[model samples]
Target chain A: MEATKKNSWLTENRRSAIAAYLFISPFFILFAIFGLFPMLFSFYLSFFRWDGLDPMTFNGLDNFRFIFSDPIFYSSIQNTFIIGLLGTLPQIVVSLLIAFALNSSLIRFRNTFRTLIFLPYITSIVAVAIIFGLVFNNQPFGFANYILSLFDGGPIRWAAEYWPVKFAIATMVFWRWVGYNTIIFLAGMQSIPRELYEAAKIDGASIGQQLRLITLPMLKRIVMFVVFTATIGSLQLFTEPLIFLGRGLREEGITVVAYLWRDAFVYNTFGTASAAAIVLFVIIITLTAINLALSNLIGRSKRRVS
Target chain B: MSTKEVGEGKFSIKKFFVYLVLVGAGLISLFPFYYMFVMSTRLNREINSVPPPFTPGNNLVENFQKVTDSIDFFGSMWNSVIVSSTITFGTLFLCSLAGYAFAKLPFKGKKVLFALILVTMMVPPQLGLIPQYYIITTLGWLNDFRAIIVPGLINAFGIFWMRQYIEDGVPYEIVEAAKMDGCSNFRVYWNVVVPMILPAFATLGIIVFMHVWNDFLWPLVVLRDPSVHTLQVALRALNDAREMDYGMIMSGTFWATVPLIFVFLLFNRLFIQSLSEGAVK
Candidate 1:
């Protein structure tokens, strides 16, 4: 009787385990269908030559080879880095400063300012991009040029010029993102004990000195998180450039993902787009790894100093 | 000597400067929206005038009509509502279900499976676009609402976020008691766990809604039929076709963004509270 009861208990436990799997099985099923299979297929497609509808011809390594030799590809890579650097670096700094200012006792109406700043972030990118297109229009009467003309500047052909187009897109990115990073940094700053600042002030430290010594050091982890997240976001920069430059400067403002989209969908060069995507993926992973390694190194040094 | 007095005077000066900077920043932040709204009410000629229209004009109705004509604005809006609402509802149900399982249930491979789910969060959606497109095409799902809704129903981030809240907020003993009362596991999850995790549901729901509502790329890729396009996609079409019609485009853009603004204002407190709480963890 004891043996039978123990066996029945084991069966009951097994039945519940089966039911639990039934409940959570959707994720695995969906992942297999949408996530894993596509990734593996993309890898396989990278080594072929096919215009999406045609038979994919096996062309091992040719697409990758072409990617290296293509000047446009190199330029796109250069543009990606420049835009990423221009967009992410200043955004992080400005966000940190704003976060600090808001955290300071000197400021008032903190929540209002925070909400206003964050509004741009939550706004639809398409709307913002369109608004910015008008603002940056190369016409003599464009908003940007009109403002610049006040300072005795000539009307700039923003879209026609390559660097100007990149700069315009970067500005939009900055405008939309700085507040988001500010909010994140502000959260990080608030978590730092007020006693740290109190003690620093007691030792006759100036506000700037306290920021440099206490705020910066304590925010290292959050900064790393911000950097890595921003790096990934920057690598995949799309819609802003797409709408800002429009159809004329497709190549000029072509981000990597935009390029991938054009190749895959517009030109139907699915295989090559897959290859480019694979390379882009690899670059992102490498950069993230480097960021992690650098953060780790900095973290260790900071720990030793403390 | 008189160091305290000097320090107090300097501190007041610093406070004055701080307010100046804060107000300036606030103006800069709000100026774009002002410009957008002002431009939306101005005609093309007024918009292009040498000085440009700095104030709102009386072209709001005209621009609204133009936007409606340029794109099926109502149709696209309805599509967006349907798609975003569906995704939000699906995400809440599926994520809450999986989150509850991971949090309360004692199941085999629960730890390993949850870890696997978390790993997907790191893989950028862009990486899978090519193959996902292929799969969608193969399944004949292009332009189908299901194409947009089904694949993204149970996202990893939602599940992870829901799990985090469930783990922290929901008590496992309550679930045990429910089970002891001859309730099935599903019943325990539904009656006991769901009610307790409403705040988590709200947070995840808002995030998911905002994302789906504003999503441009996937919708742009999958939906080829103009009739089936979402608001963002329709706005893109209008933007491309009528680059010169600042009023119409702005009006359309304004309409597209207004719902989000409403949602943000409505849930502003919860939004900020969740952000701070999530960041702390």
Candidate 2:
């Protein structure tokens, strides 16, 4: 009787295990075909020259060599970093301030403010690009130029010029994402214990001092998280610049991803594009590692100071 | 007492300054949407008037007509709806099932599988874009909805998110109890586990819907036919073709944005709470 019961339990265990596998099989199967295969294939394709029509020729490291020697490739990286910094710096700072304000007890209709601020985030980037294209039109009658005119500034060519184009694209990035980062910061702020603030208050710490000392210190991890994502996101910037400057290569505004897209789709150089993608992947991973290390260093230094 | 009163006055001034900053930021945040609406109601000439149009004009109906005539505006809208909803529903079902297994079911290699999902979440999807497009072409799925829908039906992030929610929201005792009643694993998932996790489903569903709806790059790459273009793609075509027609372009953008904004307005609090919660997690 005991032997039979043990065998039945083993059968039931096997059945449940099979059932569990069945449940999760869809994700693995789909991911293997769509996700993992594509990733591995991209690495393989980076070595061979193909134009979607001709037979692929093995080129060894020629694709990588070509990209390394390409001036456009260097410019694309420069543009990516410049625009990433332009967009991310203001976004992080402004989000922190807005989050601070919203967390204050003086604010009424808090949810109303949050919804209004987050409105921009929900809109499509294509729509934003279209609207902002006109708002920042190269023409004198553009809204931004009009506002600049009020301040006795010249009507700048917002789209065509170099710095202005980067500024315009960066503005769109900031507008769309500021609220998202604010909400995240607000959540991080809310998680900090109330007693810390109370203790600070008892010690007569002003609001600014409290934020500088207690709140900022307490929210280091969340700040690093936001900065890390922003770094990665800013590197992969595409749609805004793509829609802003059209599909053609615009030296002033073309980004790394845009360059990759152009190479593969427009130039029909899949191998070079694949090489570019791998390079971007490495850049992203390296930057992420650097960010993690920097955050850790900051944490350690702050701990020593405290 | 006099010093305390002076301190209170200073505090009120600071508070007023804070309110000023908040209200100003709010208006700036909303200005673009207002501008879009205003521009949609004006003709191109009026849009370019010395002082740009800040209020609605009588061209609202006219611009709407122009939008539909220029491109298949409604057709693309319908395409977006079909794609977004199908992907949303598909993701919720598949992700929730996988999440449940990872969260509650006892299985060999569960830890390794879940770890693999987490690692994929870190691998940027853009890395595989080229070869993924190639694969879609090879399978003859290009220009078909399946190209976008099938690959997007399940994702590592969705599975990871659902597993986290399930582990926290659903208790193990209930899973065991359902099994004690001789309920099959599928039945437990469909009947018992699902109802308890509606909020997670809603959150993931909205996220997927918004993502697929707003997606521009992949659709632009795959869907080449004019009739099959998604709204984002069609809008891009319109912008490229009619570069000077501000009113018509704005009108297309307005209509494309209205459905989402309306849904957002109706569920404002839920959207805010759930999104912030998701971010925090």
Candidate 3:
């Protein structure tokens, strides 16, 4: 009887395991076909020259060699970095301050403020770029220029010039993302134990001191998380510049991903595009490693200070 | 006594400053949408008029006509609705199922699978763009909604998110009890787990719906045919490849944004709460 019961139990357990596998099979099957295979295939495609219609020819490291020698490739990287920095640095500080202000004591209609601020995040980037394009249009009657007019400034070539193009694109990036990071920061702030502030208050710490000494240190991990995501996100910046700068307009706002897209679709250089994609992947991975290292250093320094 | 009064006065001043900052930031956030609306209501000539019309004009109906005349605005909207809902519902069901299994079931290789999902979340989807496109072409799924819907049906983040929720929200004993009562693993999940985790479903649904709605790049790449174009792609056509009428573009932008803004207004609290919760985890 005991042996029979044990057999039944083993069968039951086995059945459950099978059911579990069956349940999760969809994710794996689809991922293998659509996600995993393609990733491996992308690496493979980096070696071959194909123009979507023609038979692919094996080119070995020629694609990589061409990309390394290409000045446009280097400029695209430079544009991506400049725009990423222009967008991310001010965004981090501003969003942190916004989150801090929203979390302050006795704030009214906090949810209203949050909803309003986060409104831009949900709006389509296509729509945003379109709207901001007009706002920063090259015309004298452009909305940005109208504001300039108030300060006795003349119309600026917002789209034509390089710096202005980066600035315009970065502004769109900043506007769309600031509220997102703010909410993340606000969430981190809320998770902090209230007693930390109460204790600091009793110890004669001012609001600023409490924020600096307690909140910043405690929220280091969350800050690092925000920074890391923002970095990766900024590096992959594509649609805003694509739509903002419009097609066939060269030498400005051409992000790495945009460059890759143009290369594959416009120039029909699938091999070179794949090479660029791999290079971007490497850059992202390197940045992630650097970010992780910096975060760890910050963690160590905070520990020493405490 | 005098010093204490000064401190009290300082507190109120700081409070005022905080409110000022919050309200100022709120206005800046809102200005673009307001500008879109204003621009949509004005004539093309008035849109570029010096000082740019800050208020609504009498040209709203005309701009609306121009927008509809330029593109199949309503058709693209219906397409967006179809693609977004299908992906959203499909992702919710599949992700929740996988999440529950990962959390509750004593499955073999569960640790490795879950870790793989985590690693998948770190790798950007763009890394596989070329091959994915080639695969779609090879499968002859190009210009078809399935090209977008099928690949997006289940994502790593959704699976991870639902798993975290299930581990916290669902109890182990319940699953065991259901099984003890002759309920099959799938049956227990269908009956017991699904209802209990409706909140997670709702949160994940909102997130997925919004993302799929606003998604531009993949749809742009795959759905090139004008008839199958989603709202975002259609809007881009209106902006670039078609007409240069600012009034029409603004009107299209205004209409395209309305559905999301309406959903957002209705579920503003849930949206905020859900994001905050996601960050905490």
Q: How close is candidate 1 to the true structure, as a TM-score?
A: 0.95
For model 3 the interface RMSD, in Å, equals 1.9
* Candidates 1 and 2 compared by lDDT, better number: 2
lDDT of 2 at B155: 78
Writing each residue's lDDT as its tens digit, candidate 1 over B61-124 gives: 9999999988999999999999999999988998888887787777878888989998887777
Better of 2 and 3 by DockQ: 3
In model 3, what lDDT does residue B234 have?
A: 94
Error of 1 at B119 (Å): 1.8
Top candidate when judged by DockQ against the true structure: 3
Q: How much of the real interface does each model capture, measured as fnat?
A: 0.51, 0.67, 0.74
lDDT of 2 by residue, B205-269 (tens): 77778889999988988999988899999999988883669899899899889889999999977
Instruction: Report the number of the highest-TM-score candidate.
Output: 3
Better of 1 and 2 by DockQ: 2
Candidate order by TM-score, decreasing, is 3, 2, 1
Candidate 3 lDDT score relative to the true structure: 0.88
Measured against the true structure, the TM-scores of the candidates, in listed sequence, are 0.95, 0.95, 0.96
Question: For residue A145, what is the lDDT in candidate 1?
Answer: 88
**In candidate 2, which residue pairs get closer than 3 Å at backbone N, Cα or C atoms, i.e. clash?**
none
